[model samples]
Structure formats: C-alpha cells, structure tokens
Target: MSQSSQFSLLSQRRFAPFFWTQFLGAFNDNLFKTALMVALTYDALSWTSLDPGLLNNLIPGLFILPYVVFSATAGQIADKVEKGRLARFVKLLEVAIMLVAGIGWMTHTLWLLIAAVVGMGVHSTLFGPVKYAYLPQHLKPEELVGGNGVVEMGTFVGILLGEVAGALLVSYRPVGIELVAGASLTMALIGLAASWRIPASPAPAPDLRINYNFVAESMRNLRFSAQNRTVFLSMLGNSWFWFYGALVLSQFPVYAKDYLHGDHSVFVLLLTVFSLGIGVGSLLCEKLSGRKVEIGLVPFGSIGLSLFGIDLYFASQAYTNTALVDAFALLATPGAARILVDLVLIGVFGGLFIVPLFALIQTRCDPQHVSRTIAGMNILNALFMVAAAGVAILLLGQGFSIPDMFLVTALLNAVVAVYIFSLVPEFLMRFLAWLLIHTIHRVATVDVERIPDAGPAVLVCNHVSYVDAIVIGAASPRPIRFVMDHRIFKMPLLGWIFRTAKAIPIAPAREDPFMMERAFIDIAQALHEGDLVCIFPEGKLTSTGDMNEFRGGIAKIVERSKVPVIPMALRGLWGSVFTRDPGNLFERSFSRGLRSKLALAVGMPVAPQEATPEYLYEQVRALRGEWK
Candidate 1:
C-alpha cells in the first residue's frame, strides 16, 4: 500500500525481517570465507602442509560449485514450501554449518574447514531462488525496484563489513581465532532469529509434485524460462553482469598490489569505492525509472560500464607511483582519485545494469515459476563466472597486464550489449524513448495515473510532434503500442526504432487500403490481449502546430474493442526539433539546448459509447490549455 518509497517497506513486517535475514546470511558467508583466507595466507604452513596458492584458487570454486549442481533442485524446493518456514530452516542449517566451522577453527583442521565451506555454499544455493522470488510475492509491483536496490545495497555492505571483521579479528593471534569462531556462530544465530520473524509467504505452486531428480528438474526450469524470450534474455544479461563483476572484483587486490603499488589499505579503498558506487547506483534506479521496471536503464548502465571500464585502464596507466603506499599515501599520488572515480562509476553503472534486469525478471515471469526462472539464471550465472575465471586465467597466462584485462572486459561489454540489443530491440527501443525524454526534454506529467493500470485502454492523445508517440511512451508507466503513419514508420533512423518497437503502421485508404485494414485489425487484437494502444485521433501531426480535424479510426477502434478511452495531451512540444518548427525537423536541432521542459496532462477516461474522436479531441484540447 505504501507507494511513497521503498524505505517505508523497511518499517513494515513483510520486508524488514527478510532484509536483515538476507544481510546476515551474506555477512556470515563472507566472514567465514575471509577467516579461511587469512588462515591460509598468514598461517598456512603452521596449519597444514598444503600450498596457499592452491587453496586460494580452490576456495572460490568450492563456494560456486554448489550453485551449479543444486540450484535447480533448490528452486523446486522454494516453490513447494512456505517461504518463511523455509527461510528459518535454512537459517538453522547455517547455525549447524557455523558450529562445524567453529570446530575447524579451534582444531586448526583444514579438511573440516573446507567441508564447512562447501556446506555454506550449499546453504547459499538453497537460498538463492527464495531470496529473489520472495520479494515479488510480498512487495507491490511498483515497490520492486526499490526493494531490489535495498537488497543489493545490504548484500554489498554485509560483504564489506564481514571481510573487514574476518581479516581484522583473525590477526590478533589465538584470541582472534576464538573471536572469529564466536562471531560466526553469533551471526548465524542472529540470522536465524531474523528469519523466524519473517511473515509466512504461501507457496505459489502448492499442489505441484516435487521433483527430486536434479538434472531433470533443472531442464524443466530452463524450459520454463525459455518460454518467455524477454525474461530469459534478461536472465542472461543478469548472468553476464556477474561475470563482469567477478572478473573485475577478483582482480582488485592484484591490481592494487602490482599496478598501483599500494598495500592492503589501498586494496580496501578500491573495494570500498566500488561497493559504494553500486549501492548509490542501485538506489538511484527507483528515482531514475519513476518506480517502474524500466529496461532503458539496462542500456544506460551498460554504456557507463563499458565507458568507465575503458577509462579505468587509462587511469591506471596514469598512476606514476612505484613504491608501496598506504591508503592515505595512495590518495596523495597523482591520478589516484581518477582511478578511484572510475571504479566507483563502473560500480554505479553495474548497479544500473543489474537491478532493472532482476526486477524485470521478477515482474515479467509467471508468478508460480518465478523461483524456478531465477534458479535457472543462477545456474547460468555460476557458469558465466566460471567462464570469466577461465578468461582471466588465460589472459593472465599470456602475460597481459591487469589494466589490459580491464580494457578487454570493457570492450567485451560494449560488443555483447550491442549484440543483445540487436537480438531484442525492445531494450534499444526503450532506451531511445527513454533517452529522448531524458536528454531532449524534461517531462512532467499531471494525473497520468488516471490511465488504467490494467486491462485494455484506448489512449487518445493530440499529436504535437513527430516524436509525440515516443514522448508519450516514455511518460507512461506502462508500455504503449502506438499506431503511426506508415510513411513516418518507413523513414530513416526513426523507422528502424518504430519497427523495433512493433508499432502499428497505418496509411490513408487511397495510398494503401490493405495496410489501413491490417492496422485496424492489429489495434483490435492488441486491445483484446489487454495491451495499451495509443492513437493520434487527429491522424497526423499538425503542420501548423494546431489540432487537425479528428479522424474516424478511434471510433472504429472503440466500437470493436470497447475498452476504456483515456484522453491525453502533450503540451509545449510544438516548434521543437521533432516538430514542424519553421518547416521540417532537423532545421533547429538543439536550439533549446539539452533538456527542454515539457508537460503531459491526462484527463479521466470517457465511456466507450462517448469515446468519439471529436469528444476525445476536445478533452485533449482542454488539458492542453492552448499550449500550442
């Protein structure tokens, strides 16, 4: 019920417990892992005869392997049981694993500790599906973006804090070891308490038979994911982000040590900057997207990712320091701030790229299969991360510098983004609409919520510019299928965008009678399928920046579909670049500088019987208030 912001959800019963429970789980995992890393690095010869390098490499693999093996089965389990109870069960499992880990710590038993590591991995694999799917069930659709941002922020903060705790606490000798054990157990218990407080979330698929066969069930989930093309690709985008993240984050210590000539303090600074960037970027999504699942941010984020990623390489090259420095000394070095800013921007873009994809996955997928779909994505994420490791290894083996690796990853991001956007132009189309509104105009909407949130609706708006449909599309929270003039739909750069958007192209009866007929059929079908269809009832852009005679197509549309007719108007777009300003577009481009201010007003819906083109025209004109 709270639409004001996602921060309000933290005070409510449904989300607060889950947020803390998840945060504690992340914290405990990192704490244990960091403790093990410290033990291996500082005291490996004392604890065991094994090589530290081997353990360093093996531990990450150990943690990720369970995701590959058990995520499918985990998804099925999430769907078959109540989430609150399962979360509590998982938390208890954590306590048991930490107890074993505490013993391993006290006894200095490497094998037992390694087993504990795998157990923690299994615990995480089980929780992955529920972690994502749980939010959609409890939060309102509009609240999803903010909810995910907070979750991501919490996860990163926990990782940072846990790492610091493990490293610092383990450095104080025997007391430090004892502290590590105590902290892990205490955090596990706290997490269990938090989970116990989570409200019951009923299973979406209660009657579905449980499938114990991991491989078969995994395939079934993958199949379910494939049924929706957009959701599946969004999952792939999500996984690719993990690949990019793992590769870049894993390299920070080495980059700090070898390239920047900095000590542990510098490494921590780099990691901290990156994590904070992601947190800031994640939080910005709710504001930038207007509290909707806006895929446009995906492309924007990717662009920033690639751009800053390349800049990082150059920034690293600018670092002239050769002697090892502490965090403060590193800050004193020339270009250090630039390198740090690059990391932060990369993180910010990474957050932008990822948060929307997760929200889109949750909001777009089938409710019953959301967990399974997320599980499938987890499996792929694990695979991509493994592949990323291989890529890093191969590149490093070839004697490439860490900065060069950063460059390669940034270029790869751009290539992959272009390919994916080409395959599904919706991402690119939305980006164009989003970009136009963001760059070319400052859009303010009044009573846009008057448009129906669900079911079919005929949106009749006055046409003011060639880009009116795109402006309206960007302003509306929901997607709009615009019926456009066939000629404009066939012209140059804008044509490609129109086609990608799947816009319905229409023509006058004298020019193309069949096209007009098909356009009407498409409108009827779109309305029947509960889509929002927007038509310029004036049938053409006003050549004189005034309303044209209202056409009859809207009458035929409402007569056939009989949906609610919402009257809307775009004000203050006349005489702009996309308008017939002094004859033809492109004559006065950027005359108003970047970000021209504009407003859209939405009037109440008229009954279908009263939804004549003339009536809608007058309503739109009333809202417009002589802006033209």
Candidate 2:
C-alpha cells in the first residue's frame, strides 16, 4: 500500500461497489429532500400554508423519527441478513419510494411527499447498520480510518451535489418540480444498480433472534453498547455531535434568508461550502492521524468546532447587509467571505470530530454485535437531533436569534467535550502524546508492525529522554502499558499524561521495596490480561547520550510474565528539552532547536527463553546504531 492507499481502495472490488452504492443512496436521499425543502422555503404558499419555521424543523424530525422507532430492529435485520442482499433490497425500497415521491411531486401533494420522506427515513434506518458494520469486515484494522474517511468524504460530496441538484433543478422555470422528481427517481435506479455489484458480506450473527418490540430492543441495544464504558461514552459523544449539527444546520435555510438577506441560491451556497469543507476534513483524517484511528483528533476537532461556531455568530453580527441577493451577489458583499470561511471551518472540524469516533466505535465494539451497537448509536443520534429541534423551538419562541443558537451550541460543545474527556482521560492523554510527536518531533517507525497486534508482549526500548513512553505509545497501533520509575509521575503536566495512560509507576528496589514489589504484580496482571507493556531496560534516562548497563529488571519481567520480548530503539532524542540538557530549564527550552528528528525501530520478537538482558542489550544497541 502506498501513502495514498485509501484512494487506492476505490479501485478494488471489496470497497468500490459499496462506496458507490452508499454514495448514490445519499445523493438520492438528499436530492429528494433538498428539492422539497428549497421549494417550500422559497415558495411556501405554493407548497403549503404552514409557517416555514415549523415545516423546517418538522421535516427533519419526521425523517429522524424512524431512527428512534426502527433502528434496533433494523440493526437486528442487518446482523441476521447477508449484507449485499440487504443493501440491494434497501435500494429497491428506495426506488419504490422515489417513484411515489415523483408522483407526489407532479401532483403537488405535500402529504404524499412527506410520507415519502418518512419512507426514505425508513430506508436509511435499515441501511445504517450495514453501512458501518460492513467496513470492519472488509478492510484491515489499519484501513478502518482511511476507509471511513473515504466513505465520509463520499457521503458529504454526494450531499453537496444532491443539495446543489435539488436547488437548481427545483428553481428552474415551468417544470422545476418535474425535473426534481425525474432526477431523484433516476438516481434511485442508479443506486439500485450499484448495490447489485456489491460482493457478499457474511452476517456476523445469523442466529440472532430479533425482537420486534422497539422499546424493549432499544433498551437491549443500549445495554449492550453501555457494557463497554468507553464505547458507551463514545456513542453519546457521537450523538451529541448530531445534536450540535442539527441545531446549526437546521437553522441555515432561515439563517440564509432572514439574517443574511440572501435568496434560496444563497442557502445552496452555504450548504455547498459546508459539505465541501467536511469532505476535505474527512479526507485529511487519514493523513493527520498517520492512517490510524487516532482519537486525539477528536479533541482537536472539538476545539475547532467550538471556535468556528462562535465566530459564525460574530460574523453574522458583523454583517449589515439588508438587501436580498443571489449567491454570486452575496459573495461579492463585504462580510460574506468571513461567514463562508466560518461555515467551511465548522464543517472541516465536524469531519475531524466524527470520523475517528466512528472508527473507534467499530474497532472497540463487540464484533458480533457491531450492527446493534451502531443501531443503538443511531437511536441516540435521533434522540439528540430531536432534542436539538426542541431546543431550537424553545429558544426561538423565547426570542433567541439563529446566531444565538450557534453561540449556545458551540459553548455547549466545549462543556460536553470537557465532561467526556474527564470521564475518559485516555482520549486526552493520547492527544498529548500525539501532539508531542506531530509538533515537537517528526516520528518515523521502521518494522513497527513487529509489535504484536493482539497478544501480551514485553517491549524493551532505550530510555534516551523523559518523553520516550509518549513517543512509543503514539507510534504503536494498539495501546501499551508502560512500566516506568514512580518519581516521574510527580512532574507537573507530564505526570497527568502518564497517570492517565495508566502507566505502572515503579521505584528502585533499594529506595522502596514495597512499591517495587507492587509494580511487578501490576505488570504481571497487565500481561496476563493480554496488554502490551513497554519497559525502559536502561531504567532511567541517559545522562551522557550512551546506553546504561542492561538492568536485571527486564530479565525479571520476562521470567515472571513469560511473554516474548520485542527490542526497540529510539534514535536522535538525547539532548532535547525533555532530556538532561546541560542548559538551565529556560535556556534548554530553546537553545537547541526544540523539534528533533526521531525514529522508532522495532526488531523481530525474541522468544521468552532467549530474551536475556545481555542479549537484548546488543539487539537494541544494534537497532539504535549511532543515531544518538
């Protein structure tokens, strides 16, 4: 695989057919919905006599209602049914619904079209579990992030095109409605065609006896999801994003017309920029995350989401334009570009926030129950989106402006983010480690895959700097439990990171025998539970840029745990700020260039019987070479 391997997956049969199948599904869904929304918002009297605000919130609510009512059942169906067949069946349902919608469009019957909306919602509800659960089965663990990013990019791009198609097709003279109807039906047929090409995906739970009770199954699904604390909170975080998004996105039509003084075309422009931004951010996840499911991007994304969301409010306040204008004319206005940038950035950050969470959920959830877990999340998403609508109605009724809603959502995002991070400090810890490598040092790993993916193994690395654990942890695909000197846990900020990572803090035998004994027990337990534990055999940071004599402690660990030892080396990290730099703290901070070139080289795993201290020392030294 090349650096751009994510794009290359599109050429293979395993991923491409599914990609286009869902892409067209999204396109057709949005094509129908956006056309109806634009027509209703722009020319409401012709479509219905109802207030536009009620209709705006009501439409989305109707669409999301099925997720709450049917998602559990849908998840059960996805798990029990073969995926390719299910996908094709769902597409056929889409074709039938679009035909009904086409009829409603020609007749101008709002109720029929609204029913079609509910039907499409059912279609999506059925497909939701299949859409996500399918990826983990088809792609390698490393590919999940890139696969998800590509899918997300395709979904958003489809949405962008669909919204554009809806707006332009429905705004044309004489037969705009007919054009929308024809185009939606045609896309539905094309999506159905695409679905037929998808390869068979075996059901994970063919024997699962599905319950028909929505309330009961919904509870069961949530119970299964909540069984894992991190997965559960992640589900909530995922749902909260929808809440934030619904509040922000649902306001755009009105935000465009009433606040920005722009026409329906301007609404299209806003949606366009936002979707395009999400596409760019989604694609960037693979590159930014080093092609792994780095949840650190979650915090990074949350920060950007809140910042841009608040700025959007200010940007809207700064705009003084009062005359109605088209998209082109609005762009030429003084303050419009700022608003555009804010929307795009919000979308970009939104992509960063969401893709990793999805990947994490997939990787972390129970394999057999992936569909139900996703279904549970979908239910939560629906609930949050509904709550967003309620919040919008309540706030708007209380005289809050759309921009006020944006500000409130952004602030709430920060509060929720802090709460979630506090509950799971690993997200924050990983963020710090990821930040260190990406910012302080450029990290390259050689043969790093030799570190076991799924078994307990002892990783022995040279201790050259104070932040060696952080660098190694960030580089490993799976989590590592580090055994380090207990005193390092007393440092101010770094202490928090290590403690949050659940690093086993140890003391020298001569200093604190009790703590030393307890440390070995903890290491034994971690290994028995099948976790990767790394110990710096040098036992302390190097003072003279040379390896300390091999310590007996590693031999003791191997004897106790009886796991293979993987010797690793860190190169070019001796005189950095985090090391024993000769300069004072202030001077050491920047005297040498702060950023260092670092490489983590992993050798083949040594058998437990042969991983003696003296042998591993030579192995690590040979790997480190003269880079220091």
Candidate 3:
C-alpha cells in the first residue's frame, strides 16, 4: 500500500518502455498541434489564404476526424495483430509523418503540415485501443489503478511539455520553424526506440477477420461495448470528461487574452498550472485508493469539478485590470491568483475523475474484446469532443461570455453526474461506504485477502453495529451482498442506501414468513451465481457489545448452496452512535464522532463442510477477543 510499491513498476521491463513509447507519442502530437495552432492564430506565417478562425477550428476537427473514421478498424487491427509489433509500426509511422511535417514546416507548405496532423490523428486512433488494453495484459488487478495513474500522469506531462516546448521554440524568429520540425522528428525517433524495448504481447484474437467498412464496424463495436452495462456506462463517463475538458480548454486563449488581459507568457502559465495539477492528482490516486480500483474517487472528483468550475466563473467575472500583463505581473495582480488556483483545482479534480474510470473499463471488460471496447470508447470520446466544440460554437454565437460558458458547463456536469449515478447506484453506494470509513472512523483491515478475490463465498461475521456492513463492504476489495435484518434495511435514509447496495433484506419467520423464505432463496441464487454473500450469524446487532448465540439461518444457507465461509470480526464500534446504546440508535450514532478508530479482522476461510454456525462464531470471537 506504499507509494514506492505502486511506483516500482517503473523499474520493470513490462511497463517502463511502453510508458515512454506512449509518452513520446503524446508529446509529439501536442508539439505539432501547438506549433500549428500558434502559426494559424498569431499570423506567424502567410502560407495560406484561409481565414484564421476557419483554420483554427479546422485543425482540431482534422485531428480528431480519424478517431471517428478509423477507430473501429484500428481496434480490430489491435486485436488481430501482436501489440508490441503493432506499437513499433505505429511509432515508425509517426517518424515518417514527422519527416513529412518537417519538410512542410521548412517550406511553409500548409497542405503538407495539415496532412501531418491528419496522419497523427490516424496514428493516435490506432494506438488508442492498444494503450488501455495493454495494461490489463501486463499488470495484476490490484496494480491496475497505480499503473493507469502513472500512464495518465505521463500522458498529461508529455502534453504539457510538448505545448510549452512548441510555444517557446516557435517564438525564436526564423530558425524557430526548423526547430519545430526537428523536435517532432527527434521525438518520433525516440518513441520508436522506446517501442523497440517493449515486451511481446501476442494477438488476443488473431482470427478476427478484417472489416474495412468502418461505418458498420463502428456500429458493431459500439453494440459490443454496450452489452456490458458497467463498461458501457464507464465509457459514457469517460466521454463526458472529454466533453467537459474540451469546453474548458477551447476557451483558454480567449479567456486569457480578453478576460484576464494576459500576454502569451501568462497563457503558458495557466497551462502549466493546470497541467502540473493533473500530474500531481493522477499520481496521488494510487495512494488515495490504497492501490485498488476505488471508484469512490469518481464521486469525490465530480463534486470538486462542479464546485471549482462554478467558483472559477465567479472568480473571473471581473478582472483586476484590462491592461495586458506578463506572467509575473499576472501573478502579482490582486485577484489573478484565484483564477489560477481555480484552474489548477479543476485539473486536479479532473485527474481524479478520469483515472478510475479508465482502470474500471480495462479491468471489467471482456479480455478478448478489450481493444475493441477501447476503440468504441475512443469513438465515443471523439463524438463527445466534437459535440463539445459544436456546443461551444453555438453558445459563443449567442454572445455569451467565456465565464458564462464555464457556468453552463459546470451545471451540465452536475446533471450528467446525477444521471450516471442513478443508472449505476454502485458508484453512489461506494461513495457512501468510502464516506463512512473516511469520516466516521479510521478502519484498519487485517487479512482482508482471506476474502476470495473471485467466485462464490459465504462471509460470516459478528455484527457489532448498524454500520458494520458498510465498513466491511468498504474494506473489501470485491463487492459483497449483505443479508441484513429487514427492519434495518427499511430504515429511513439508510434503506435506500442498502437497497442500492443490493443487500438482501431478511426477517424472522414469525415476523414475515414469506419474506424470510424469499431472502433465503435469494441467498442461494446469489451464491449459485458465484457472488459473495455476507451474513451475520447472530442475525442481529449486539445490544450489549457482547457475543450472541449463533442462528440456524446460516446452516440453511449452506444446506442450500455450500461455499467457502470466511469468518470475520468487527473489533470496534462498541459505543459508536450506530450502536444500540442507552438511548435510541440515532442518539448514540455519532457518540465517538469523527476519527474514531476501528479494526476489521478476517480469518482464514473454512471449508463448506466444516463451516457450521458455531465454528464461525468461535472463529470470529477469537479474532475479536482482545478488542472486544
């Protein structure tokens, strides 16, 4: 769970070379794009007669055009071909394209340069599926989040460095153009060199026949991706992030110039701030998630994005001055620092928002279709970015200010978050679990690995308090279905949370015989389907913070569908507010308040035949002995 362990992947041949290969690709793309953008926007050259506005917009469209047109075919190619070999080929193509781009830069040949842009777009489209799909093939499930964080951090860092390098190199008079060309070519070659060191990854589906008809193939890939509910929704969330990023970034130049009244250096400063924030945030994800695929960060990230975005709108509503300022002067300005902070926070929150979703998609999707699924995600991302541009144009045409646009996008983000969370309540449930552990207690879990990583299992624990299930669920790496008293499941606000978590509600036969029977049936089916079912053998929370006699309901469960039973103990929460103390549950819930310490100890799994109610009770009691 340490940061070094997460970062040690850098020293391994399995990850490092692929990391640089991707890094160089991203660097080259931004390098060329920035050079072209500066050339078009600032009248750095008189090579073309087209309107600057038209060219400025046309460039982004041309670059992303391939993602829409060729991503499906690219996905199939990734699946059918060996990845290491394909990556080298892609890098070689980048070198060739850069060579052509260099010639265009030297001669100021607009068409040639534009062709290079389109070529890079295709290169990216081909590599897109390979980038994400490569990780799961090489890294373990627990290492995925950290690995992805490193990759994302490297990508954004490359982008930032490329943009800065391009802008600086372009500013140096006549030799500037040649330097841009040289840099692109040099980076491409370096990328090719790095790609050579990547270890081999055989084709996942060598028999998948090529289908050149991109339109129909794209639809098919989309359909394939949609078949998995969580993966597809994750794709939608990823696309929405792109949409939000595109809208915010597309306005930076104008916002910097007209609103902040800053010069080019100031614009670079803004980019640097946001870029560094993302790099830091992305790297921080590994530690925040404790080296797991923790989606709780998603909701946390969304909330920060909305809050900061809205604040940014208000922060930039009135600039301190209308006169242009250099980077230093801009920082020195009274209110300018707030704008910069907001930008940085927005980027930080964005990094937090995106990394988990990417990891989730890679790990959750079918192994065979990973590349194609990524291709589908790329296609959707392209469409969302394009739609983002269109929406920006439409709103700007209506004479809205950039700040107003930010506000609108912020509001739209809130709406999108709510919609997605509703569709997959696990996100919200995880958030709640994460919140409970983070705010209410510092939960230390031991031997949580005893819980099966996959397949059917029965988790037997001594129920200590009302919040015991949430704590256990949060600490567990895999999802759990808890069997709780129907009354607690029907509690006011807590009821909805339990239902969303898919917790089974059980009752005594005397209270509701039909419900009790239905609960047992659900438990058997869940176990039959290879899900993890957690049941408190005592069948109720401890009223006196002591052990209760084991119930026969657990025996009924094992009789119906036997599975490995993991014995666990809750070693804290004796007097916490959620416990049934001297007063009502509500009155005692926050008695220990914030930062209360707790521990959950999971014992070795007992075989189904040996896992009687009494045995599990004794195991849990032993585990909890001293603390209890």
Candidate 4:
C-alpha cells in the first residue's frame, strides 16, 4: 500500500473506530470534569463546605492519583489482553462511571461525583499504554507521525468541544436539577458506540503472567526505561511538558477572571485558543517532521514554550481593569498580540516537542515492554502534573501573581531544557543535525516526487560525507531509515542521532557475520512493514568525488522485500567542510551563508527485478546533474 493509501485505510474500520473511541473517551473525560467544576464554582453551597479553590486543586490531584497508582497494572493488562476487547470493556466501564456521575449530578453530591471522577481517571490510566502501543501494531512506521498527529489533534479538539458542552449543559436545569446526568450518559453511549468499531488488536504477549505487585513491577519498568539513557531522558522531557502545561492551564481561569477581568466565557475562549493551538501544532508535526520522529523539533518546542511563556507574563501585565472583556476586547488590548502570538507558538512548539518523544519511545523501546515503558512514563506525567498544581498553589499563596508565575515557569523551563538535553545529548545532536542540514547548506531536491509516497521502497544514495544521512533526511519529504556503517553508527555525537532515527548499523560480512545478517533481517522487516529504507550501497564514504560501484546489498534487500528501489544522488557536497576535501585544520570551508548550493536529485522507482549496481548507479549519476 502507498503511504497515502495506508493513511486513508486508517480512516476505515482498522483505525478510525479506535481513533474516535479514544477521542470520545478524552472528550467525555473533560466534559464530566468541566461540568463538575462549574457545578462546584456556581453551586458549591449545595455540595460541600469546601472552598472552590481548594476543591479545584484537590480535584486535579485526585484524578492524577490513579495514573500514579494504576498505570503499572494497566500496562500489564494491555500486554496480556487483546486491545480491542480491552477497549470495549473500558468503554463499558465508562458507561457505568458516567451513570454514577449522573447520579451525583442529580443529587448535587460532590463526594459521589469526585469518586466518579477518580473512576474515570483510572479508566484513562489503563487506556494510556494501549492507546499508544496500539498504533505501532496497526499502522506502518511511516504512518506513525500522521497517525499520532491525528490522535493528538482529535484529543485536543475533543477536550475543547467537551468543555464547551459541559459549560453549556451543566447550566441546564431540568426540573430544577442540573442536567449533567443526561449529558454524561449520552456522551458515554456515543463513546461506547465508537469503541464498538475498534478493530481487533491481538495481544503481543498474551500468555505473560500477571504481576500483581504494582510497586515492584512499576519500579522495574522505570529501571528498564532508565537502562536506555536516551529513552529514559526523553520520558523525563515528556513529563516536564505536562508539568509546564498544567502550570499554565491551572492559571487560565484565574488569569481570565482577574487579569483580563473576563467572566466564564473568557475562560472558555482562552482554553479554545490554547487547545486550537495544540491542534494546529500537532497537525503540523507530520508536515514539519517530513513524516519522521524528528527529535530536533523538541528543542525548538522548549525554546518557544519558554520565550512565549515569558512574553505572556508581559502581555498580562498590560491589563489594569476588573471589568469583564469578551474575546474581541481581550484581543484589542495593547499587549494582546504578544500574548496571542506566544500562546500559538507555545502550542506549535509543544506539538514539535511531544510527537517525536512519543514516537522515539515507541521506535526505540523493546517491543515486549513498550507498553510498560509508556505506563511508567504516564506515572511520571501524573506526578509532574500533581507537582505543578502544588507549585501553583504555593506560588499563589506566596502572593505571586498568575502572570509572574508564568514568567517563573518560563524561566524554569529553560533550566530544565538545558539539563535534560545535557543529560541526553540526542536532543542536542538532532538539533545539531537539523541545524547543519537546514542552515549550513541550501539543498535543492529534485525528483523527490518520484519516490513513492507510500508502501515499501529502497532508497540508494551515494555516500559522500559523514552526515550524508542527515542531509538526505532533511531533503526527503518522508522519513527514510538509513543503513549506516557500524563505526559511524557509534560516533560520539552522531551516534545518538542515528540511534534515535533507528538507523540500522551494519558490519561488513568479513568483520561480523552475525551483525551483517541481523542488519539485513532488520531491513527486511522494516520494508515488510511498509517503511522507506535507504542505503549507501557503496558501503562507505567515497574517497574521491566519484560514486563507487553499488554493492550487491541493495539487490539482497530488494530480492527479499520485493520493494521498489528509488535512486538518489547528492552533489556539491564533495568540497564541503565535512567532506574529505583539502582544507586548513582551523579554517571553516563550507560555512553557512556561503551561497553553497547543494542538490539532491531522485529518480523514478525501478522494479526489483531490474535493479542492478550499474543500472542504479546510472540513475543516481543522472540525477546528480552537472557538478563543478
């Protein structure tokens, strides 16, 4: 299947049902929670003696508690059971929980509703691992970014829709009782219906014995995650995002009311802007990433989050009145442009930050324990969110304004980003790779459109310099998993980028037969699963400017996978700084803004049967065009 067609297939039974099922689940979660919040704020006198602020803080804490406590077990269950069946059952539980929420709403029983909220939290906790792990099983690796983008977009839009609905419906008083009961039940039914369409997802490790010791097992998962230093730190980076987000989101209600002097409608509008920003950013990830797990974007996201977050503080400083302002009024303020721009950038960078991390976790983690690792990440996310609330409470108690809190959070983000990237240099490495390819050279790619947009295909390119893969990556429209020399794969800084990109490292048959065989097997599997695989068939970087004889390895890959082979060529890189050209030791030759014009020319796909060293070489040579 072509990449576009494969993506379209996901909109069919195999994927769409699961997508909407998850969407509705997220939607209903926010719906009931928002309704409860409204009920507590406007009708708190009827529920309990607790202050709304305390309850607000307590509610988020209570909801996160299950993620911390139950994710370990949930991860186990997702691994042990069929995902489709588990999804349906979870939806059924949602129905029962929503019924409880209805009962609490009708009786105005805050305690009961809070319990139901906890129940929903537990449901989400269990669903977390399955929600992510399920994607690798159903979609092609090339589809990962697009699929994840859709999921993230759906989730945020669902939350926005749910909040809007909750605000409107909770105010509804049918026969003098809040109509939250009817709304919750109806949304639950819709979610259940969606779950019914989730196609079968057979368990990967169904016979694995259940581990009832949640603490020990959770710790084990965490330790396993830590074993892969890069993956582990990425998890931390992921968790920190939640912390950053929670702190920002927690202040919105207060910011709208106190700073902007807006009522409930303003609060909703602010959330809409934030959520819509996330949706836009998430959707853009697929495009920006070139359909790969582009970790380089993570640093970009962090930078924006911090910069915009600080700007937001200044934006809010311009506000002086307690009078209510609608969306238009808020936008009309002197500093509103900065605030709006910051919020939108924060969301955009957030999409860049998160999607790659999730993809990295999926692609890099052990297939057997991927779900468990995700669960462990979820636990950390829960902890970070809880801490965010606590930090916000502490800051507010210390007489810090919400805007000041945003500034503090923004500054802290820079510190955390520096620390995390320092520990796991892959983020920095990718940033370097991204920078080198994007800035150091102005690459013009031709015949890229000849590369199939979908299905399994082999890319044969001339290996010019050490950073050939990075350059190809930046030029190509789709992610291409490169087969690299084992030594280059182990380079100090470049190795991290290769590992994150899931580059297959190969040893020559004479050096390590086992490693060579494994590399071939990995390539075959990737192609079989419908991924774009690229190879430097010349085996090593060229000593001269001429392309070497293409090796039989390309033939071996195609013979096994029967995938189309697309020939590619890189020119004008021969005399570049990284190339083996003559240059003074301390002198930089191919610096950025030197007007160096790099070119990548691709050729039409050739049938596997017709693939040969000479034929492929000629195609690539032709694509390279006239070079100086």
Off by over 4 Å in 1: 1-3, 41-44, 47-57, 583-593
TM-score computed on alpha carbons, candidate 2: 0.98
- Candidate 2, residues 1-628, lDDT tens digits: the string is 6645899999989999999999998888888888888888989999889888878878888888999999999999999999999999999999999989988999889999999999999999999999999999999988999999999999999989998899889999788998999999999989989888899999999998989999999999999899899899999999998999888888888999999898878999999999999999999999988878889889989999999999999998999999989999999998999999999999999999999999999998999999999999999999999899889989988999999999999999999999999998888888888899888889999998798868899999999888999999989888899998888899998888888899999999899999999999999999999999999988888888899878898888889989999999999887787788576778666755646678999999999999989999999999999998
Estimate TM-scores for all models.
Answer: 0.94, 0.98, 0.96, 0.79
Please give, for residues 1-628, the per-residue lDDT of candidate 1 as tens digits: 5559777888988999999999999999988887787667657788878655445546766777788889998888899899999999999999999999999989988888999999999999889999999999998877899999999888888887777787678867659889999999999999999998899999998887878788888888888898889898998899999888877876765677678887656766887889889888998898888888889899999999999999999998888889889889988899999999999999899889999999989988888898888899989888888787778777877988889989999999999999888888988888888898887789888998887767899898888888888888887777788899998866898888888888999999989999999999999999999899999888778878788878899889888988899998899898887776675445556566778888999999899999887787889889999877
- Superposed on all Cα atoms, the candidates' RMSDs to the truth, in angstroms, are 2.3, 1.4, 1.9, 6.6
Candidate with best TM-score: 2
lDDT of each: 0.86, 0.91, 0.87, 0.82
Assess the local accuracy of residue 218 in candidate 1 as a C-alpha lDDT between 0 and 100. 80
- Which residue runs does candidate 4 get wrong by more than 4 Å? 1-10, 172-177, 436-469, 473-568, 572-628
lDDT of 1 at 79: 91
Q: Candidate 1 at 323: error in angstroms?
A: 2.1
10 residues in a row with least lDDT, candidate 3: 49-58
